[model samples]
Target: MKRAAALTAAVATATVPLLALASPAMAQQPAKTAAVQTQVLDWLSLDALSGTALAQRVKELLGKGYVPSALNVTNATNPQYTSLWVKDTVGKVNVLQGLSATDLPKQIDQQVKSGFQPKLITGTGTGPSAVFAAVFEKTTQLAKSQLSMSKETFAKVNAEFTAAGYSIASLDVYGTVEKPLYAAVWVAGAATGAVQVTLGQTVEERGKELLAKTKQGLQPVLMAVEPGKLYTTVWSKGSATGLKEYLNLSKLTYTLKSAEMKALGYSPKILSAEDGVIASVWSKK
Candidate 1:
């Protein structure tokens, strides 16, 4: 996943205590679902600090294990002061302020040496000074079930669905396991709403079973799918990273530049003309 962008404030300095403000309304709102909670706060009053000192203080905060994953600094209200939003681990956020370069700690230099570079940092001439940061933690591994797939027999099974009047919207295949294989496809039938077909074990057997099941369970409700809404294919040897993995399978090579291709750990030129190419990047693994 890409790193979150940072927010920046433009004020030079202002007299505001970090702990003097009321808790933000978001802090009071009840948690919903299982998503990460984020909050904004006032970290320091930078009314009297110099630019160098401000930088130092930022270094100090980072050194204490507060490396921001996203950092936003702005100066809209006070010309000198800036507000900051710092998101740390789950349920932890710090809003602080800095007075000057002197007020900044010395740990910032170390952060730059590390990979925690800010995505955006700009200065404006109005509003409350603010900075937003997204702290980094260990990358969470998606569950195995979330990434497993089979490739060998998916084409045949999907073909059966198409023959039964179901439009296959998306076909995803992965080369996991052997013998039975594993595969998944998203299909839209006239009557079955949107359904996902997952095949596990014995590719040929599962494919036959899936064909029979679709005829028995899905064909009765298959609706006429809309035309012109082209379905794009994507393939990747790497683990699925959302829609990006499919880019290679669809052969969208022209859309991928050197930098983007490198970032995805893929080579843009390693594609075939007969293979599916959308926009200019290789869409197949």
Candidate 2:
């Protein structure tokens, strides 16, 4: 389907001096668990795909050594998908889609019993009727996880879980005009450091928030939008050597900006698109 006409010009890029934040050492270490397989990932971004098409494309990519990193239904009403994939040698990854809220938990349990863990989970639609898409990797099970929770419930649990020495491993938002809900997976032995979550922010507001946070060495990890309406984002403290954002751009401008950013050694960390707008965060490779 044709997307809505292009919106305003792209927001200016935000830049900050390199900050010396300590990168996590655990991420680089080899996995000790029998289910764990670790390797470097080469990222790829894809947008404007339908459900059936995305399923087919994912199968092709998996054969070429890529796994899903992020996935969202940008336009739930029209049902367009925007996703990010990482080229890695992760063995035995399972991708599940179109699961009802009731079935998601059972599927997660089944996968875990088969020596897999949920790496990415996204919810689309609202309330009990919502459907989920998830990717499970052969890894140790998470210490805590929840799905299809309301905004208020998620915030409370997110705070409680963070205080208990767990960090959000995967998070996603669902619902557009109505109140949003969240799905998250948390793992033990990590702390949520310098985190920021934005809800119902307009494009301009989100751009400003993005600017302010990146300057303080924060990076956007997850971003979801409600078609032509609000946006939600999650930011966490990170090394901000070459952080930049291009917000609310038309398709043409997004293409132009992406090429320039690639030439400047920047690759996208989070990419969101809806109703003819493309907003993305990029960092130096």
Candidate 3:
């Protein structure tokens, strides 16, 4: 079960260029730090777990052990799957989980077009930091049943999105023991621009090529891998504004535990600690 616990962590604050555009809200007396690490732990825990009770599984993992620092994605892709990744001294693991706030499929497009209410979580953590949007949470779908596809299959999948009126922003295909069988795509809003593979490196001489690609104004938010598989997500400016943002996990704390850091000395700028997860950014005291 632990072998399935693949996850990812932010590439560190300096890696993302958009943090330069911190809204005035973050520039107050004490700047806010994004909750990056928290998300990583959650993503890892979900993969290490199995069964039907999503909440219980999460609870069990939290109690076992994890750091609370960063983001959480809501209404990601289809509720049939939610992405969570973690990394550490051992290795990197990314998970595609069939999870939801409620027991129905997530229609993310409709939610965005209508009204999107974020699911708020609370609990314990390392320190206190402001709540932030999960770095990148796109609509991702993993096959319900194992399936395989050819290079033509990629073309057909792209066509399906085009016909539906959405564009393919970024996608990574997965395979079983031999052929490419499953994939998850990050859908784009505009069909006009191009998602270019500007940066790339061969993962293996003949096996695969992992690259950093970008389109619109979005950046590659997360890159995760599990043995022979990989998953990546890219994003664009949601609002007309050109600014892009990503969470940086500054603190981590666990449930049934008291804050280990000096909570009183530092002034809190951002805070979101609930349901066994803790995220916060504090001002220099």
Candidate 4:
């Protein structure tokens, strides 16, 4: 069944201070022109797709030069998949679904050794029975990456890395409701400008913060939800122009809003689900 979507806009109010560190690689970018960047049209967004259906869809997308950039599994026990697929340069890509906790690490190591990077990792369940779903790509632009860290450890590492001139491109959370593990992909050629993270916030609280942060020029890069209905959101620097986001919306509202945004020349760049509620970020083309 199709679902509805929602949309909201925000204005800048405040700013968050971030360390000014950029690698030499980051400083070599060419100047930008006034012309708007070309809008990407070859993409698909899935909202609460069933596991069985997702398997077939994944195969189809891979053959069409599309890859999953972000993924989440709602209702971990039953497993409903949500993901964002975007067209990418043709290269080797792999997807692993529902791998046991013990096996996930080993498999990730194997893939990394084989010249592939885990582009996205989503875990479900907790403790010994937790399972992970990952997408690996051979043509990744990552400089350094880490996965399977506790909340406390991630904070420490995030601080250290930010100071060392690395910016997080993506983050994934999984495990128990009280203590979720985090995985992040780091790139060296970027600045960790103006970062904000909200942990263990309720859907409403996170939504409010998201609005405020985006109003202050911070864009959400990742939003993770726990079984206990808590939300963790990570934000980094982004232009308020051409950006809009919606959070904690029902499937019907989400679908409706998505269509409205599409008609206005916007595309969903981020999509994730938790306990049947959806959160998404749409950017103007």
Candidate 5:
């Protein structure tokens, strides 16, 4: 999701420092005049060029007579704007990257210390590539970091999976790891069915003990779910035996709708039971 615009306080903080550093005489001068504004417009015309082209264009503008204080650009289409601010003085420039939702005062302080008065600010976000292009258009500095997911502690559970006979295929650390989440594993023989297992924390803790009990209880009815099929399962708040019973009934109903039943050239009546919770099984006529 896009972030909101930076707060005004952040903007002020970023710019105030540099503005304060001007010579006493310069400090006494009035705010930017119309002539300086005109110069800024001439310099900012470089916004037309995007990506590397824009960066090169900025260099060209700088080579001419344009002294860019700051250039701010944001994605117009994103509900939350991703902004890029660059402050330039003499030949030195510092770029401050922030989301529109950032505190403006902090941003201003940082910008001021970096030099350059705030100049051009624009927004554009029409196409997918445009967002990235606009953000990276004027310079080549990038930072990368990883974010962790916020959820109940699952570190111990992850370790347990390793300790068990399951091979971890992939772990997505950016989201919750509970039911409805997809995680692949390499199991032996019964791997054909796209069977999603929902194990409660209690069951997971018991591990093999629970597995053994389930195997004994469902030995007669448990069938292999089709392999490689994507299925979703949830850990319902109920007895383990009851959950297995529901799955068994669901599988039986699914069997009635299989290709084999259709090959008989007969249409069967299907109905929903328990408010569509349980699918009713039917035989071909």
Candidate 6:
């Protein structure tokens, strides 16, 4: 099968400055039902946190339903300011801890005041000890009996990645809108040598390929899944830096990439995609 052109770019390098912020620790709750994952954009934050601290916080936030559908982390060293990917819930909320306290709030305010159409602002850089997390927020499950097609689709995607010299580091499910989607996060091969195969593909093309798998004459509508897309974040241990790409939206990627998204922040694009298939959005901070 002919492949879609995958976009590729290298992340820049920077020395990670470590800074810590103290916020009221969120209370934990019972685990929610597992559901599918969806990709979303329209959020950007300057989270000042410790990576280990943030990791522990993620587990709790997901439990309490803070709405961090999915997030990513950056590699850093004796990090002064560690970039944390926190969970967020549906609706308007300030997911970042002390970001607004800084000039960041004014930055957000000025953007709206000046009408600066946002292109790409910035996210946290990294250090050698940097850890990149391709995290998916788990929400309460909807569909009881698992769909047969879900397993099959995962199988096909797995096979392709294996052939491409990438392996699944983790797989998870999360709830969204009415139902949910799956998230298959990967850890790449060492910088020693990697297959030149495409790492990222357009979501639309991926959907078609998924439908065409096994030559089983599978109808698209049977799995005409809602809210499905592809996303990935590539970071270099050698450089302790990374680049995140969250594109191939069922809708236009450009729309999600907005300052309004930065201010309103992200809340999983599931509501936007509905029952459609979407790849949960990722970040490099």
Q: What would the TM-scores of all predictions be?
A: 0.20, 0.75, 0.31, 0.77, 0.20, 0.24
| Candidate 3, poorest ten consecutive residues by summed lDDT | 122-131
Best by TM-score: 4
Report, for every candidate in turn, its global Cα lDDT versus the true structure: 0.26, 0.64, 0.26, 0.65, 0.26, 0.28
Error of 6 at 40 (Å): 19
Over the stretch 29-111, how does candidate 6's per-residue lDDT look in tens digits?
22122222333322222233354455455444334333333232221232122222233334221222112113333433433
Error of 3 at 17 (Å): 30
Off by over 4 Å in 3: 1-47, 52-148, 169-172, 185-188, 196-218, 221-285
TM-score of 2: 0.75
TM-score between candidate 5 and the true structure: 0.20
Error of 2 at 161 (Å): 1.2
- 123-200 in candidate 3: lDDT tens per residue? 111112111121222123211111123446655665565566555432333322133332234343444444322111
Candidate 5 lDDT tens digits, 16-36: 111101100111223231112
In terms of lDDT, model 4 sits at 0.65
Candidate 1 weakest ten by summed lDDT: 220-229
Weakest 10 consecutive residues of candidate 2 by summed lDDT:
18-27
For residues 143-201, write the lDDT of model 2, one tens digit per residue: 56797677789889988988888887777767545666677887776644777778768
**Model 3: per-residue Cα lDDT at residue 128:** 20
Q: For residues 1-285, could you state the per-residue lDDT of candidate 1 as single tens digits? A: 111222222222223223221111112223122222233322311222233444555554443333332222223232222222232323222223332222112212322344222122222221122221222222221111111222434556555655666454322221212221222223334323444343322323433543454454432111110011111132212322221211121212222232243334342221111112111221212
RMSD of each: 22.4, 12.7, 16.1, 12.9, 27.2, 20.9
